[model samples]
Target: MRQSFGERFDVPDGYLNTASIGIPSASAGEAVAAAVAGWRSGAGRAGEYDEYVERARAGFAALVGLGADRVATGPAVSALVGLVAAALPAGARVLVAGGEFTSVTWPFAAQADRGVTVTEVDLAQVGPRAAEFDLVAVSVVQSADGRLVDLDGLRAARGSGTRVLLDATQSLGWLDADLSWADAVVAAGYKWLLSPRGVAWMAVGPELAATPVAAGWFAGADRWAQIYGLPMTLAPDARRLDTSPAWYCHVGAAVALPWLAGLDRSAVHTHCVGLADSFRAGLGMEPAGSAIVSVTRDGAGERLAAAGVVSAARAGAARLAFHLYNTEADVARALDALTP
Candidate 1:
């Protein structure tokens, strides 16, 4: 029998801060706990962690609808974005959405010394103006206010020969979209994927021709065998772009990701968005069709905290996110806190 989402997580009522960090499932928590216990007792083998890394890589591939060979493991999205930033030709024009998370924009912006100009446009305009730029980098969902990108517009822009790089940090776990067409896709595992910090993944598409500038031993075709070699030999696929695995993080992710991948994502999306819309309606706002809601009232952050409702303050608003573990009671508690 399948465990209910509520059964999988022991989240307390009034906890609504999934946008900042996710509560791990009971199984994942136990796996990490056991791994830590082994480490503390000097009973853990480093060699065993390689399997965990591979399992996590494959699970993320399944979630994003890609092959494991196209996915590269890393510790941070910024580091993976740096790999792509370094591959751009001198004088390349990069288009980015205004207010995009710096991890997606700063990497390309940092390359200005090489004549790589990163131009910021309204989030809505990124796709229509894509043909004018060499590359378009943006998040699947904006981090500040939860505005969704116009994916169809980006798809049309791809037809015009503009390469697209998407940061799915906010959307991957709940947003169901076919991302295989993009030149590259990157995500941090901690926020929505329910993994501990230090685990991330990047998918390199056929259209992206970026070289692995930060290749290390983990990037080798046979990393164990290539540990001490004069000539550097890297993996034939995206693994060549990998940073060394953070073993403990992967151990938890190996259990969490595959379990998440097996669930009916469409149902999960509906549950989350339904809760978010209910909260919006409570505040006399129309449904935004996103799982995240930003309340901009004065002292909203303090009020939520006072009411014991967990949320994040970002861009001058109190941001509340709904996930599978959240329920209607949480929305009511937050509304009670803010309205009264």
Candidate 2:
């Protein structure tokens, strides 16, 4: 039999399915369900809806150990990243890891076209190149093998002038990863945070909030109303970075953050590690410490997909991501489904 391993959180029945991509959910997602229902109907922008959206920003900030004012909501992770690129200077030397998820990689390419000098490097070697780049963007966990990068070291290496954008989609809820060093972080509510797919958030530090490049209409403080087709004075925090209304998505993302806050992150981390370990032990796969286990083989993605199991490819390996909602039995079931 070929080797197999899985995280208990990797189980697919959860709201956020890591089977498709990124981190598995760590909480329930009732808020999003309500938000979407409201959007679908003509409910459109109600006061309660807007309040929940703001609450979601606070909830997201709470999870990352930041002030609520520092968090901003987006339509999706991709849109949040676009805002980041738009905010940075056109000539900024943006550094990204080679072989990152395309969502991250393509943004830089577009940034390059707009004038940012984009450099893709092996992040293991980022410490050396950090001083030269104006900004360093990285996925908290490598999307392929779920390799956890030393974010603290990376931040220090960037020196005081550089901005660090960390994508926590793969590692946010479970891992004991410290995000205090980051200037900005964008993550999807679906992955790891247990919300649905429509929500994503970006949190910015105090310094960046004061002077953002992509200043949006939704960023103003107080009860903002149109004053002759112009934006009112902006808010003091990260909300200023948000350009449009993502009211519905906010409801779900907000609920997910606090719900995850109830569970023990340390326990979830241990559970994920243990489940990954169990899969390796039973399947004889080489043990990789990530919440994900991946391997290289011909037609690997196709093979797994055909078996009713979904996995993503990175370079030569196929990755199976896991998280808090996954159970031991899930690994077994997926393995059975994948039987060749």
* Top candidate, metric lDDT: 1
In model 1, state the lDDT of residue 68.
95
Off by over 4 Å in 2: 1-45, 113-115, 209-217, 299-310, 313-316, 335-340
Q: How close is candidate 2 to the true structure, as a TM-score?
A: 0.82
> Which candidate wins on TM-score?
1
List the RMSD of every prediction in angstroms. Answer: 1.7, 5.0
Q: Residue 252 of model 2: what lDDT?
A: 59
Minimum summed lDDT over a 10-residue window in model 1 is located at: 1-10
Residues 233-340 of candidate 2: C-alpha lDDT, one tens digit per residue: 777667766766556556656666765665676787888877766665555676666787775656656666665655676668777766666667756655654444
lDDT for each residue of candidate 1 in 246-276, tens digit (9 for 90 to 100):
8889999998888878879889899889999
